[model samples]
Target: MYPDYAKKPRNVRLGLCTNDFAPHGQYGRTYSCWPIIITPYNLPPSMCMSSKYMFLTMVIPGLSNPKHLIDVYLEPLIEELLQLWHHGRKACYFDWHRQFLPEHHPYRRNKKAFTKNRIENKVARPRLTGNQPLDRVANISLAVEMPLSLPDGYSSDHKWTKKTIFWDLSYWSTLLIQHNLDVMHIEKNVFDSIFNTIMDIKGKIKDNMNAHRNLKIIWNRPELELDERRPNIMPKVVYTLVKEQKRRVCEWIRGLKFPDGYASNLPRCVDMTELRMHGMKSHDWHVFMQKLIQIAFREMLPEHVWSALTKVSLLLQRICSTTVDVHKFHELENSVSIIMCNLEKIFPPAFIDSIEHLIVHLSYEARVGGPV
Candidate 1:
């Protein structure tokens, strides 16, 4: 439960906000409402007394830093709090940074330096003469001139400032303490990157051939044998078969009926001729790779290729479940670790690190009921 001041109707105002384009062909629309009174008092007795928290205050669109829209959203709320009987000077920004950098890391150290300079020289510095509240908020604007010098391998170039209204020192009492990492997004991204690597998509290292050869050697069964007697297929022929297979698969997917209780949103069927692998979510990718691929193109693909795909698919399928036991998650981690170690070329060290990081957290999250 929040403080008594937070529950006060006079001290709070709430609205659900969204941006939408005009029906014709216009863009850049703005809409706001302060009419909705969404305090706990308006809710039913049972709902109001529920443990779950809800704060439907103000919403600001766009990702720009110095747009003044965020300031507009918070300014009135701050004023109301200030006017309240139990006004508190202390405020905190809860920053969820997915690409987490540790305290000792150079990037984090650089951010700390930037934060310190902004706080001491700008935010905390006394103003000469102006509206005190406006001046206080203006001090919160952090300059983005300083470029982050990262380690050699990092791909990003210094193009934009990292300043946000959330980092405004004047509004928040504690700067560093407020910033935290969202483990869910981090895990999602890590899983996506790993999946991309295995599929050899999105510029990831393509060692599918090596994986195929390794799989052939490991699974030296007669059923998984390469037909040496058959003549080599032409490149054009292979391409045509692949294209046709994709079209058929797309048709099948559209016709397929999902059973009740499927957790993920049903993937929309797209015309493969018009859109090549468009409208697919992360879960769709997993499903396609794990179940659809082999079923759709069973006879067309080579034994080695099929075997390699199956191996990766099975491994990923085991770990990518919506609900995984702690023991299963641990087993998945160990299995992935072994695979990464055994097939260095197929699963590059950097790619493997992403998988490992997510796997390490998966068990903890499972124990806690869900991802954070």
Candidate 2:
């Protein structure tokens, strides 16, 4: 939002307006010759909002010790977020860069003890932070929502990134492993759940877009053509776009599939659809599985491991951006299994041995529960 090419003063203004700063309580009566005397009316509402928001949002929460908020609130927020979203969590001053508030931006080289710039930014979700560093500013773009819980036996398969890798290793490894396995067992069923959920969401979004498109199209439709029922729905423009998107998704799923020697070779998108025909279970989630997996690998795996990861990442990136194609199934499966094996190598021998044990434990547990 801040204009970049301007002179220092203008840049500062742009940054200040964007940064969170509270309204001045009441300016000093003194008039200084060196500094330009500016009145309160001259200040933007955003600046005032920024300051008050920071004080209320950051300071009041931790009056005991500055670190208390960081430890109790910020730390937990980060940890919980890492668990929930699989991304690194960091907090910074809302607007330290322009006026130089202390620790305004976590990525900054120098930070102060008292200034306010506290914000939690996800390392993986860089867009969420945007160009300006501010806290609690109203944002309408890119709002994310995630399901918090899934069916009794299902779990989210989101990946945790490097930023949270250490945290995950310390606290989430066991729970995450169990969840991952549970998810894999019911993977086919979950696809149906995902597809239906996405379809519903897309349906709504498509409805709105279609409505708007129809209004515009009707307004411009030639007078003679207007009487022909206005075509009930907007012209196929929006529908075509929606179709293209769904087609891409289906193609992506199909592309990722590989041929198996046996009938149950591997679960294709079709299998996922079949499972969906029946009731499917799921959880609410903010993170997409593709991004989550990338974050997890980046956080958990070493550089050497990335060589293999890069290959799969490229495939996944394509799948995420475009759609699924079953024809690519063999490549996808083999690539993923290899990557999984490589990741298995990253853990300590004990961890690996424990996984072996866990496999047995899970098998027994699965049997007790019913089928795998």
Candidate 3:
């Protein structure tokens, strides 16, 4: 059996993260710097995330993002990583996150929630024990480098962008988690979709005329089928609030208060004139969704709609907790699966896109890779 190298003493498990950001206080400039950061996950959670522990390995001076070409500049760092590949194991990155969830979870039994009529009954195959993945990749030709001589079904059935330079490291395949999900960005997206749809904001709402028509064709709902009476008008659905309800929700938010340093001035972001929220950063949305979302809109929306939103808020709350209970991750996973299934049944198709679906994986990620 393979030992968990990441937990071994004196092991330096490096996390490589890079993104382009506009320099603070230079608001006038349109340019941004692409900076790569290295953090030692070997440190305790309290110290690992601190600025004191983060090391800036390299910075690409940029007026524009180098995109994939950033890899070209990272050659030196890649070489160093190859040399320091201390664990010396070989493996493959698993794509499925749901494999970490309990096998008997009801999320896998629902037909309508995910795909059409088909339930998720198959358990995800476990990762191959040893040299299998390396052998498999050796047969996969990189299409970017050699386009003409690609093997059969390269583009259609299985897509291989390129075996990344990181895979060259001796210990790379030993990691349980290859990439961490950006929880904040995903949280903001879910918040935006739900809030905008319920507010019935013109351009932002997903429960528009088109989605209504699509739903009518797909499912049997007597109340929603009333659009046949007034073909020109998009009949109002229960998910969206009436104008008065929208106004009341906005007014409540406009005067809302929170303890100092608990969250930002959320009241400033609510625009009574437009009846929509604005200027909210990702953190602000995170705080609002996990804490104030269900409470603020409690009586304004229908019982079912409000209940679904509250469940989502609770899921976010538990996942983002300061302390993660490793034993309860299975319970968390089961809850998330059911919550997502309920939301899928309630929200419109556009509202249930990738960001919303990403909720199903958050628990699994936390189980394998703790809080991030």
Candidate 4:
């Protein structure tokens, strides 16, 4: 690695990002395409993120994410980078573009990318910024699937997965801000969990038989524990909305209107009959979490529950603002922990996902890494 690379602004400083997206809506046949994009940090802020300048390095196509096996496809990219660093910079060492294509999809079969002639069956499966939930999840094997909380004997103890392929880059560890949490995405995940659980959307919310059974295993809230006499019936919880409340919340969102271009037509996202919101975009989630959340739930939930949710929303608004207040930032850094604990008491344990706990660390990152 060149020591002067940082001093020389012309040197390419790469930022790589990828996420699973369905080009043709979420329903019907399932399709996911992970677009691997690269951007040079040397460009001006205006052009840094411009699609014209960004490069689509690779596209991993399949029914689900590669998960741990992603490194196999990235080997070429790694070799190219290694050559550039160790053997001096040079472009176009190898022509391995087709390696990025999908080998076999759930809908159709195709030649394997790496082993060309070999036919392989489809492989399965599918962050917030800021903080780590030390007691993250129960012991789980990552190869099978993503870390899942066990309904029985669930433990918050931290469990880590294998190191990422990016670590193969020699200079990666030396970077001051090695990785930053994607705050916008974290906001959406948190909102989805909270909003869905509160509205009690079937199959979407975290509170269920698993969560109810989990209470008995953890031995925390005796009140929420499933009664031996009525194991089939779940006890009512404070965080959820009744049938009427869910109907009203959905109706309110359906009828509300916003100024042109200020936000999307959120009315369409609401399902009147189902009493739930669907198809909300990232920015729409941002608006709802940072602004509309408190007002929408003001009457639906209990005062204490509403107050806790409001604090969570307010924390996001403050953190996402154009500027961060030193005084408020410190207060936020300290206060998020208490708020998280309050939420733990109110919502089911299953509700405490990684993103939900990430609020505890946002203030720390904001202070250290500058404004988000």
Task: Give all candidate RMSDs, comma-separated.
Answer: 21.6, 23.1, 15.9, 21.9
Please write out the lDDT profile of model 3 over residues 10-70, one tens digit for every residue. 3468888988878885857978888899999877889888999999988888778798889
Using lDDT as the measure, what is the rank order of every candidate, best first?
Answer: 3, 4, 1, 2
Candidate 3, which segments miss by more than 4 Å at Cα? 1-155
* lDDT string, candidate 4, 145-195, tens digits: 543222232222222443344444766655545577888899999999899
- Per-candidate TM-score against the hidden true structure: 0.33, 0.18, 0.65, 0.56
Q: Each prediction's Cα lDDT score?
A: 0.40, 0.30, 0.72, 0.68
Off by over 4 Å in 2: 1-181, 184-194, 197-332, 335-372
Model 4 ranges off by over 4 Å: 1-175
Error of 1 at 346 (Å): 5.9
Task: List the pairs of residues colliding in candidate 4.
Answer: 129-181, 135-156, 136-156
Between candidates 1 and 2, the lDDT winner = 1
| Model 1 lDDT at residue 128 | 26
Model 2: lDDT to the true structure? 0.30
Best by lDDT: 3
